[model samples]
Target: MSKTTIIDKEAARQIREGMKADCTKCFSLCCTALNIVASSDFSINKPAGTPCLNLQPNYSCQIHSQLRDKGFKGCTVFDCLGAGQVVSQVTFKGQSWRGNPEIGKKMFQVFPIMEQLHEMIAYVSEALSYEIPEDIADKLSIQLKKLQYLTELDADDLLALDLIMYRFSLNELLTIASNFVREKAISKLPGNRNIKDFDHARVDWIGKKLEGKDLRASDFRGAYLIASDMRNSDLREVNFIGADLRDVNLGGADLSTSMFLTQMQINSAKGNEMTRLPIYIQKPSHW
Candidate 1:
């Protein structure tokens, strides 16, 4: 992978001080290269590799205020560990993906790798903040140095990098993520009749532990599913527009072919490979 020089002190301070990190330095690659689909959390549908219509010329989300109402719940869930601002300012020196459309895609492709590195930084920093692990200090130093290098590389070098190097550190951090922050908490809220594309007369959610539930083609318009556990529910062809699904555990829910649902909403919900979403609702390239 290409070496990166994006770990400047200003960027580092954001991670250290903001709890929330901005990767604006790398030219807002996430906003430009990524598509945000519509779902219960976000109301609009976005296509892959296409700049979101909701994204402003400044590369900020135009609907940041009403993200939840518009079906952008996923955006709310993501924490970049200060990657955006750093990538914008430190690595690429504030150049935006918009300036060079062809190179833009390449920059976008490099983003996930950098994001992974930063996530580790956040995880490690969190650990050090709680209590220093004296034995892990040496290991942590090595990773920090690697993290700094990973941010400065051009797209070509990043693509060429041997993932095994980053994987070594990542494997160690994954354990920490699992031990300290595995699904800290989740809640499932009820959807209102805000969006109705299915018949409410022929469905049932009462007492249904939806985790892994299979409801493909079932009508679920205006259902009161508050606190319902639908984590891995199979909801192909079911209607969920206007559904209130806050705090729902949908880690592995399958809503492939779900009716009247937008990509943004699907992206908003919590999911994984097990979480079946519409074909349009692309799964995260990362695990």
Candidate 2:
């Protein structure tokens, strides 16, 4: 397998489009495959492989419109990144677990693996969206193809995948891309004297008040930012991969160019109409 494949802008866009969830094409896999713990996000505890009580026979959520109001905020935050549709339509050849009782267990098992592969693909696709160096773009394109190939594997092959190792390798590439963009953005900052002060990778900022700060191009990977007040922050070009954004305030913040920000992360946080998000991420309806 080649380690470098050039993906054009249109191809990259299509790859990203494929990663967005389309619930109409899915079999409500998340409702059945995931174990829900009773928390503020979920109204009740449901065992894995057991369909939620609100799941209709047609595989649609009975209370889809009222998920958040009904205390099913977790459901609203969950995104399969188009994994469910791929597993249902491609992997299993349009077979429904409900119709084919024998495939139910295996289908449930494959969904999560497919979700992870799709996620890696989505991130790599996003990295490729940026105007990075040629070497990094080639490497990201290669990783994107590799992850997409993994999603096409059989259920057993997906189950056998060493996701930890793949994630470790992919994270290195993503970090390199992130640093390149962040450094470039920081260099262009006016006065340009406080460059060394922006490195906040993996820091603890839980419940901290940081309202209206010029936080452009900061490295915040794996940071604990739960419940932080980050309203009106200039978050452009900042890296937020693996950052715990639950309950964080993003009201009036500009995250238009934030690196590796996912729909799930944005959905978990508190944001309003004024929060500027990346073009790919939709503002949460509840916001």
Candidate 3:
């Protein structure tokens, strides 16, 4: 991995664009297929395949504008990665589950499968965008195509697919991609900040107080940084692919150059307007 091949900035933009949720084009599959629990983030316990209480007749959330204030903050953080619309419009041909009860259960089952495929596409796209060796990039591209192809399958085919196998293959590619980006980040750092200081594979900084630390070019792939204090941290070129960011403090943290930090992760974390985010994520009004 070389600095010249660190195309994550552009690659992140492309993946985010492709995965951006378009509620208008979707049948609100997430509000129906997924289960919700009563917690700090949710207001009630909803079973799988059951429509949410706040779901409207038009397949939209009635309280979409006030989800957080109404104790549905979890809803705000969750992303279907464009699978909701793909399942609703593409797989089902715009035939919603509302009037068709027979296909409703099937749709519920397929929605999650499609969501998983879309999630893989998101990560695989990022992996392909990294600056790795040509052989690895070619392999990643093949995996990416396979994941994308799965998203285009019909309900029965999608349900019959072996997700565990696909996941295993994708995980192998993701490991390669994660390592490539992390090594590239480390190469850009000064001599004193060596690679040994940071955890590359699965850094465990959970609940650690790392405020204002110089964490430039650190590998945070699948790192557990939940509830960690990272305020004003120098996170330039840090690879954040698959990192747990829930409740992670990012006040004044310079993440403008961070790699693979998605909008969903940013929304879940505790950040102020002063937090330096990548160009793709808008500054939340709550911040």
Of the candidates shown, which would achieve the greatest lDDT relative to the real structure?
Answer: 2
Regions more than 4 Å wrong, model 1: 1-19, 23-27, 130-133, 173-287
Candidate 2, run of 10 with poorest lDDT: 1-10
Question: lDDT per residue, candidate 3, 137-220, as tens digits?
Answer: 766667766777778888899999999998888777676666676667777767755565666547777899999999887778
**TM-score per model over all chains:** 0.52, 0.95, 0.88
As for TM-score, the candidate ahead, 1 or 2, is: 2
RMSD of 1: 14.6
RMSD of each: 14.6, 1.9, 3.7
Model 2 superposed RMSD (Cα): 1.9
- Tens digits of per-residue lDDT, candidate 2, 146-203, equal 8878888888898899999999889888988888888788779887455467878789
Better of 1 and 2 by lDDT: 2
TM-score, ranked from best to worst: 2, 3, 1
Taken over the whole model, the C-alpha lDDT of each candidate is 0.54, 0.87, 0.80
Which residue runs does candidate 3 get wrong by more than 4 Å?
1-16, 192-196, 200-204
Best by TM-score: 2
**In model 3, what is the error at residue 160, expressed in angstroms?**
1.7
Instruction: Give the per-residue lDDT of model 1 (tens digit) for 1-287.
Output: 12243233344434444434444444556556566666664566665557777778767788877766676656665555566666666556667677587666766776666666666565443333322234444454456666667777766777777766776655565344222221121112234322232245334454457666555544454465545688767765455644544445567776654543433344434556677664334564422
Local error of candidate 2 at 161, Å? 1.1
